[model samples]
Target: MTTLPRSYWCHRDFDGPGRGRLELQSMTTPYPGRAVTWMRESVRDALTGLDRPTFGIAWAWLGNHQASGAAIRELRQGRPYTFTLPAPDGHWTWSAHPVSVLPVIETCANAPSSRQQLVPAHANGDPP
Candidate 1:
């Protein structure tokens, strides 16, 4: 099993509509309060190609479950697409540089609208 960094949790899409997507959400330090979801196969491949451990460092964020009022951007201005979440205050409480790019993965095209309500985190069968 891959050991996750401190405060970083790996989320598997499993049987959900976003099956192929890999996400990592962190709760402290680095880009705290950022949730990054990689969507494009090309970008995911590139990051994976760079190095598992190294790429793992750049892999995910602590996304705002609401999916609105976020900004989207690219890692290098190319084909790799990602989904990033920013804090409610929009400040990088942990780092001087805030990663504010809210990338839209390929699967996001078929995703429900941002206004759609999502299942509460507590309802995923995990104890709150």
Candidate 2:
């Protein structure tokens, strides 16, 4: 169980559709390559449950330094609104708030795909 540095940060974004992206980075210097690799794997493992098509396409990326302030602002306004960086041991996690990002995950899982929206409307011009 490696201890996550205090400088660690995570960002999550939802495209309002079924797509979502997650990025993890660290602000501290001398970042260990092994630690970064572990972090990436840990994130992938954490999101394995969202592999279903209903969850849409979820992608995780690794960042070098702190994410831009603009990106953070945009994420805060999105469905995720918060994120967590968990240690590989699953014993500890860090976040600004106590809330989990599950709401965003669930939203993506339930969101209708573009193909589903292409259905023809009823006589009244309303969706059937």
Candidate 3:
């Protein structure tokens, strides 16, 4: 498990053209855990350069039994997760949260770390 300060900037990506689309910065130690996810549109746009929605939440990391998951906010469909942005000292400040953590967490649970995010930096090695 990762460690967090009592308060830190939190960012969660919303899945649509609303409050959930832009990056958010907030502070949350959490009563339990937070839901974070990538919008199907954002990642799809980023990956294909076509600007479309490609995926949805599948699963997430809670403790063992362990399916003890909660929404980032009540009634919110956001996918909760844990991971902070990196600070200057190589520390991840708790900013830039995802809209859902489900797919990433489940992916991590099975795949090797190096194989994750299996795609070229750019289809042709240029910035998106």
Candidate 4:
């Protein structure tokens, strides 16, 4: 069976107090050309959803599953890096510069640890 390149990110509810959860996304391309096309669309879609110019970086840590904790640390330290995906002809590399690196919380499910805790919104009363 062929394996696909995967990516992960930690997500937390900014409106409430809770441990973050790990989110996974994967992409598989049979050729170098398709790999480049897939990555470009994926990155573009992600950037479009965000209101800012920053983006997060994730690497494939396991056999098409999980994220690399070591790589995340290196990226957090402001190190320049790139992730390469192998293809039949060559390879595809993707890199990004994020405004901030969000911390990943160790949790099996996406549930808050405490129900009584609630985080305050922004100072301007804007919904975060």
lDDT to native, each model: 0.33, 0.36, 0.33, 0.38
Clash totals for all candidate models: 9, 0, 20, 0
Residue-level lDDT of model 4, residues 70-104, one tens digit each, is: 44554455453345444333333454322333445
TM-score of each: 0.19, 0.22, 0.20, 0.26
Summarize candidate 2's per-residue lDDT along 11-125 as a digit string, tens digits.
Answer: 2333332333334433221223333344444546556554343223223233423432433443344322133443222222322211222222456558766764656777547
For candidate 2, the TM-score is 0.22
Model 4: lDDT equals: 0.38
Local accuracy of candidate 1 as per-residue lDDT tens digits, 1-128: 65333222212122324334535322222222332332222234445334444354435432233321232232222222234323222211111123334334688658788642566656877675
For lDDT, candidate 3 versus 4, the one ahead is: 4
Preferred candidate (TM-score higher): 3 or 4: 4
Off by more than 4 A, model 3: 1-9, 13-23, 34-53, 58-128
Tens digit of lDDT per residue, candidate 3, span 26-113? 5433333432232212222333322222212111221222332333442133334443222222222222233322222445568676
The better candidate by lDDT, 1 or 4, is 4
Candidate number that wins on lDDT, 1 or 2: 2
Question: What lDDT does model 1 reach?
Answer: 0.33
**Candidate 3: lDDT of 66?**
30
lDDT of 3 at 56: 20
The CA lDDT at 26 in model 4 is: 46
